[model samples]
Target: MDTTVNGEPRVLATDAAVALIDEIRRDYPDILFHQSGGCCDGSSPMCYPTDDFIVGDHDVKLGEISGVPVYISASQFEAWKHTQLIIDVVAGRGGMFSLDNGREKRFLTRSRMFGGGEACAIPGVQKVV
Candidate 1:
């Protein structure tokens, strides 16, 4: 295993995205993000109140960005396992059920394929699935 502090699994949020999340935090101090793979949002990162949303057994924790925990469904994780998720902010409304809605800007997901060894070395990822 890679023992470097940087080896820890990380989810990145752009400055603009972090700023928006901070603004939303004023009202929802404990918010979480789930990158849905289904339709409607089409892989957009969705943010919700931690108390209001439930992280399912099949979900995987992808570390947090700006104090907000980020999760992805098992099925989605399978497809995204080789990629690093980068959260970004874009103009427009967010998901209807997400906290970013009505904020005039929404969170988006960008990614980069991980280098072979780095992918396996990313801490906090379950090697089994």
Candidate 2:
């Protein structure tokens, strides 16, 4: 429920996303998501068992999406800080390493920029290396 401008927990989920996350939890209760900066997954939000991916100082915790911790690269955070990320589920295969893969559905991240009063107070995000 926390939405600090730059703080962790900036990412949120839609009903569909939450449902999908719950479904994934059945098999992998400790899963998490990291927005791919590029390369292997082409910026898709990749899901994995939390213990699988290593969070480093360069990664910033954006927030929790559907109870799953969501993180983005520090550089991406600098570019996307003004926007709010909304996680959703769409029909398709996700990144091969993502837990959602092979499920006929993939997790998606949609974003919108803050407006008006909110534009000036984009909160700071936190990082857990």
Q: Which candidate is the best by lDDT?
A: 1
Per-candidate TM equals 0.82, 0.82
The positional error of residue 123 in candidate 2, measured at the CA in angstroms, is 25
lDDT of 1 at 89: 87
- Deviating ranges (above 4 Å) for candidate 1: 1-8, 116-129
Q: How many steric overlaps does candidate 2 have?
A: 8
Tell me the deviation in Å of residue 47 in model 2: 0.6
- Give candidate 2 misplaced runs (Cα > 4 Å): 1-3, 6-9, 117-129
lDDT of 1 by residue, 49-73 (tens): 9999999999988877877778999
Give me the displacement of residue 111 in model 2, in angstroms: 0.6
